[model samples]
Target: MLKNRFNIAASLLAIILSVGFIGAPIGPNNGDPTGGRPTNGRPTDDGPNPKQTIALGDRREIFADRFLIREMKGARLVMHPPRDEGPVMHFDQPWESNAPAYITILKDGDTYRAYYRGGHQRANGKKEDNTCYAESRDGIHWEKPNLGLIEANGSKNNNIILEESPLTHNFTPFLDNNPSAPQNQRFKAIGGTNKTGLLPFASANGKDWKKMQEKAVINEGLLDSQNVAFWSESEQMYVCYFRTWTGGNDRGYRSVSRATSPDFLHWSKPVEMTFGDRPYEHIYTQQTSPYFRAPHIYVAIGSRFVPHRQIATLDQLNELKVDPGQHKGLSEPFLMTSRGGNVYDRTFMEAFIRPAMGLNHWSARTNYPSLNIVPVGDGEMSLYVNQDYAQPTGHLRRYSMRLDGFSSINAPYEGGAVKTKTLTFTGKALEINYSTSAIGEVRIALQDENGKDLPGFSLLDSEQLVGNEVARTVTWNGKTDLSAWAGKPVQLHIYLKDADLYSIRFK
Candidate 1:
């Protein structure tokens, strides 16, 4: 169990509230004039209603705002390789670090099924093509089942998925933003890519798998048929967004190629969607198109340099522009900053997000320019991500909020308590200005008018600590999709019982 145990500090005794000062510019001729254009009827329009107002400090404050530190208590890297104790799997040798692709979860009555790719670097010059499976009763804790499934290497490849040679085709197994796909409902993952050509394969039960076709999906064509499919009911197709490079240049054309099938077989032709800077995006780079899953949107992970790794939804993807280089309504894309760690190759193999913790506690990563999102977990919904600082070794870490004291408009900073005052918010996102000496867990909570807990509102992402509270700001990314806490009086509550919290501001 990956647990975070800490001690609580003594409770504060008194509560205080203080008013935030905002400055309004005093116009001329209101009382004592400086530039009061000699008006006739005793000064016109009350001196133009003061020009602007400046904020002295925060206009509003959150009281009793606690952070609920839900540590990924039992969620650890299930398939991290190069371990000295485990049965040394041949593929995981020279184990610098193992990158994880997508971890999919399936629910069968009371039991749950999981499948994930255990990715490592290509040691001994092996062409990096190995995918495996594991299981758990509760999603958090997992174990490899002794099932005599998937085999490697053969003349035509018998028990293997697919061989990534000049002879066969391979696709990175990246899950499409299809909510209705079997893979989303626990089918096998079959596509995604690395820094090179396409590598594609499929699985039945996620463990016992086989290659779909002996030949590559795209035979030396402009497009590489990587496994980037998403289930679309409107089109009734399993659409895969693939990348096509031309002349081995730094740029390539990106298209959402569709392979339609009633089942996972017997496909249709590819449909192309080119948006953004195709050449720049295709230059040893891979990216996913933007699709709406209601409040949240999904983006794919790839990089031209640094061996192309994974990244989560650090920022909202810009609205897709149908015309490339048109300078339309598209916002600038947010560049993923690599979080440093040593579990994998520092210079290579980065971690990106697959999806939010859904049926199980499985998340994903990539390595060796390899791609594939596998199912993971048995019964948990815990997921952890690392910052891309590109360090090679140490604890794969995440930053969290640290709680401090609170002040109010009615009371001063007597202790850590707040002199209860009602607050109104009319913004989209909330900001938490906090400081931490170290990285740890910090939880936040919210309540309604009747003081009922709002369902499905929690901060599960990494907390990137900037510096001291007075200098840096720790923000809680938008967990709730509502435009703002409008029309509803959402009393903010935070729990730093397990950690520390500074201050919170509603955006």
Candidate 2:
């Protein structure tokens, strides 16, 4: 790696970047730091209001992608923590060491499956390090079935998914949801090194695999991170996000690059993922996956690596048996969201998952989030994290977030409001996933295209909503039915006082 001027600037940005403040304006007004005004049309005594009417089905809309927020006052995006579910899988085999770090979790139909690079033993004794697999009925408990698929050294009596390829370094795969995808290629993966670039792999049952081609699809950066790819239903194409360099020694500093392919084989030239007005930080694994409930919303809950920024004391490291070479840095899960493009909306720069209250968590390479966030139970979702990396205690742990709860439009007790862009929907009632303090309340109002309050749907008619709920139907004038305005263009004026609105949708 060579240090350049841009690398120097990025290094400074990374060093100065705080978990809470990521070059965003979270000051008194609590408004859009980029100054985004109402998108449709400003409310005036004489203008009509419809910007572009959208049909909102049972889709759960979130603040993560800014698809709904047109203008907000005294409300900002908030990050939610993933509740730890403890370590569910381990690398205990002689072939499988504690170095099985880069893990991927996915919910396949009803079966939850996980894949990871589980060996560093090519230099030790094994023929090659291999990609391993684990399965679960529910995501909480895991079992590594003896797949008998690939032979790592001599025996096929292991959970190894793939072996004898450079792809095992950091193999990342996705369950293909593309309707036109071939049955045998239901599971697709991308992994390799800059020496050979990123190669594509496909599997019929996610166990037996075949290389799509000998040539690498992308060869821009040092593909050391867990390079992830998936069939994008939202864009009707295949999108891949992988590692890159900004400016540094030869490879530069850690950054992200994106490319798209109409077909899985051909891809556009790689482009760097940009964050608007935000300083750059090293993103270790950009585990970009589509939200299960709302397919349009893509979330990147990846490991934010801050190099050489040590926080653990010498005694603490010694007590936990931390690696002295890796102790100078720390990492945490940070979130970045996208609709479908090269840009990531880094609205919140805070650690999505912090180090646990212990000495082991303060070391480097821990807290790296897994590839996918899958639905674990009814109305609940789970994501796996690799913790205590490179230690004897290293294993994959689970964490959870509410459905559509990655970020929210929150209001303080002083009160704030969110006005949606003009939208048209065909639903009977408006429902919200929200929570409020006892004294807090939320009210909803339907507005005409001109931004005037629609009759019988004004804020005054809206019943005061007070409670914590995953789903609460908004009522107005003792009526919860919104069928009268169904299939028409309207805007939502939501007033919140000491409340957090996680998501909204209609039935």
Candidate 3:
């Protein structure tokens, strides 16, 4: 009887070992019972468990991407369109009657400067294009100053800045913000064709420009569009985003390429930007620049061109006086973002600046945005666009939005919650740019690294935040200061009810 009992026990032990039940149980954290390793087999050194905590030190984070969001219950990220401000200036001059394209506007100190190409064929039968200039005290009211630099229409009384043939076809300029940049090169520009490569020009006062080099500085990629270059404060270098053909040999869809330079003259090898897993589309003009408020994040309001996608009828085209062969393709603006890298995060793949309520807006090349978004008023920023292209009514229009209002974390009346990834910040209080209805409210809770609500900072203790404001300080139980939790790794549990949270910063 004893021998039989021993045999049974031995048989049971053998079965248990065969089923692999001797170790810890499988879990969501890559089967690691301690939750030390992520599913990607990477080991994290911060926080309590599966993921790493981010060190976001007092930088304003916009809801344009999912870089800081960890989880959400019923809230969603939504994109907001700008309000149309109507046409500010028309291409009505004799030299600008044909088409005025590739517009660029920048805020230089107290003054606003604008640059664009004026395309027209002279009476001598010479097809020449000139770079024109305009100025504005405020961004809304513009004046075409008589530059008197280049002669057009048998006189030098127009706002013609430069008449260099191929260069003026698409001359784009930017105000340099590099602290080390010489005063003589305060304003820099890049303009040329694919055949001539890209030529570099510099100016001290932005009205007079001269070539920095006799030869083209950048020779790689197709330099046919409004190639933009600027001093990147975050990257501490000069970066340029230009046009390129994806599949090479000028075959595939239109794309963008980037290159860096320690100085403006010597550039590194160009790297084509990648949009991960998104469907291929022609990106005609990539007006990419760093957001003025958040210099670390780059915003691109690019023109998405769809070839042969005609939307206007023949009657509508004839009524609008659109030029022949330019009505076959349609283009609209789309928004993209990046964090100083070659990968663009196209969160919203839809049209950002849609066509207006007229058939003329549905024509080809009608809504290309300018290169930069500049602050115009308190808590307000504006962007410019070229409208009614290839028509006699070609003009520039302004669009306005609240600062850092590109995208938002929105919730309906029923309410929802968004929990941020673990992070450490440096400021004593939290500020949010948000809007809400009459009955809507927002509440915030502070959670520890382990996801437990900290005492005195739970949702029950948070005061209800109501009304619409661009920068409102968040408080808990009438306490506004958060200096105690400044350097600690914590998570934000944002509860919203019929509200839109545009951006947040620790200040």
Candidate 4:
């Protein structure tokens, strides 16, 4: 079986909007209270849910659309903090700050355990690196564990638990990954190193890690050194994901790579992974990192910054825009595939929706979207888009829908939106007709109560439609008897990119 991988490309943006709901109720309908509609005092609950508003608090924030590419012809470059809102933490120190490539969530009884790699960086001109630790009760706010574990260049007082040993700089950590496999009490971690050979350290408790006495877990002898690992049940084997570079570009060296591992021990050689223009076209990028299986799927997050954003305004002033051209990517999320060999290749690529409104750019004020997939129903899931669009202060805006209904990730239509209407009935086929200027595109998928996309039911079919007079007409010719879609509470995902619907008839 092929390895299933999900990558969220870096290019986080913050979006901000200044709007308030006078009378909005914050209650849990299903997933997040933020996924509800607002009450506009019309004797009906047909308004934006006030509870869904995300507050930017004291950081530089923006709307989620900044990096999400919600609009096709929108802005391409979105900064982390919209403006110098004073001390915005877009890119922090200790190199580990940006080293959030992979993360794992462990269920230690009633407590949810999280282990992540703090990337490498020089502190105030120091050569050492460090990894931090934090635990969460509700998986939201985290508290530091007062353990004596510490990594290299880290303070015993700070959240540092394990310092980089002689093996290499301490990296990401993973615990008892294979649940279906034996109940082995195994733990592992991988990262970069300055030593000649043997890197990566494994331990029983995160504190006392032992160096891999065997081959190097991951050592391509290149820069941007980062490695992530996890266990897979489908294949019944352990797997690792990592990145590395090859040569240099106009600005500097250019590297795009990925790799997989069977056991946390011996690692396969690195394989190159590239997207977009010439390798050197984009600058300052990190390999894709892996995340744990919460809702049940191998998730990875990778980041890269377009040098154009970092350039002095007077230099590349013509490249800036309010609506970014996100599709032409230098930075975006993608799906990775693990074939037989050591390298895990990229299957499909798409822009990850930022939890906030805008892109994480340097010039203008911006915010990067925080993203995570949530389970909606048996075969449905919802995308919780927490944005600060409505209020410059920041507010949560939600768009819920099924995961499999749309043909492609870039389907112009979203699952749950103001214009989205839910239709229920019992029949062999489902058809829809609308009245609008043009029906931009059609996305037919199922979703959950929270409007997240489900995994199993992702049967997608898309087509570019032509406009018919003032109203446009589109239909879903069920390839399979969709009678199953009826009576069982299924969602119909219809996107109105360029058209509106006056009436929707199902037959």
- Alpha-carbon lDDT, every model: 0.30, 0.77, 0.83, 0.35
The better-scoring model by lDDT among 2 and 4 is 2
Please tell me which model should have the higher lDDT, number 2 or number 3: 3
- TM-scores, all models, native as reference: 0.35, 0.86, 0.88, 0.45
**Cα RMSD to the true fold for all candidates:** 18.2, 11.5, 11.2, 18.4
Poorest lDDT segment (10 consecutive residues) of candidate 3: 39-48
Identify the leading candidate in terms of TM-score.
3
Candidate 4 on 1-507: residue-level lDDT in tens? Answer: 122111101101010011111122223331111223322221112222322322211121111111111112111111111111122112232434332323334434444444444445446664444555556554333465666655435544445555453333436566645654333336666655546333556676555566666566566644333444555544456555443444565445444454555665666676665432222322222322222221122333344434334322433323443223221223322223232223322222333433222342332212222233333334333322212111123212223323222112221222111212233455554433322234343334454434443443332332323343212233333243455555543343333333332222233
Report the C-alpha lDDT of model 2 over 283-326, residue by residue, as the tens digit. 88888888877778788998988886878788878778765666
Task: Report the CA-based lDDT of candidate 3 relative to the real structure.
Answer: 0.83
User: Against the true structure, whose lDDT is highest?
Assistant: 3
Per-residue alpha-carbon lDDT of model 1 for 251-308, expressed as tens digits? 4333233344544554555444322121233322233322221111122334333223
Q: Given candidate 2, what's the lDDT at residue 225?
A: 76
* Per-residue lDDT over 159-232 for candidate 3, one digit per residue giving the tens place of the 0 to 100 score: 98888878988888888889999999999998898878889999999889999987988889878778989989
lDDT score, residue 444, model 1? Answer: 44
Better of 1 and 2 by TM-score: 2
